[model samples]
Target: MAAVELHVDNRLLDDFEAIRPKLNGHEIGRRSSPVSDDVTVLTMEMVTAPSHARTMEVTLRRVDDQLRVGEIHYWDEHGIFIVPEVPFREVAG
Candidate 1:
């Protein structure tokens, strides 16, 4: 598969960083795909154990010329889980 580059702003990265500690696994890799001109979906591959893994997806939307995390999703053995938007905050300039 071909790789697509996802351009994200500093605030989005900062928000992801804030929630990193809460995630169940260590991030192994990440990839992003543009859903539209205003939206992009970032998928992170995580490893919880030597043979166990999970995936997390973060949907980013552009509003007022700034990219903000709109939603988060996680997939595990149980099923897909939708994460709340409360953990993400808009950073001040």
Candidate 2:
């Protein structure tokens, strides 16, 4: 699989870097497998701290110089801190 360019701007990258230390370093780990011509599935495995594993899949669409992120859906294992169910930062209960 070839590496694709990210569509986001530099500021997003900078922001990600700024808070890099806080994240567990597993939020954006992606793996890819080919499905057919012009179609590929990306598997993003997420580990939400202490001990958990969740995976998500997103479709890729090729358009000239860039690959667009298309149709994202996931098989969530529902870890302690990921997605809409949990907050990015924990609130005192």
Q: Which candidate comes out best when scored by TM-score? A: 1
Error of 2 at 83 (Å): 14
Task: State the C-alpha lDDT per candidate.
Answer: 0.45, 0.36
Give per-residue CA lDDT, model 1, range 19-65, as digits (tens): 55654444444435444354334433333321222434557676786
What lDDT score goes with residue 39 in model 1? 36
Q: TM-scores, in order shown?
A: 0.32, 0.28
Q: What CA root-mean-square deviation does each model show from the true structure?
A: 12.5, 11.4
Worst 10 residues of 2 by lDDT: 1-10
- Across 1-93, the per-residue lDDT of candidate 2 in tens digits comes to 112212223334444344334433333332233333432232322333222334433354656754554543333255233343444787899
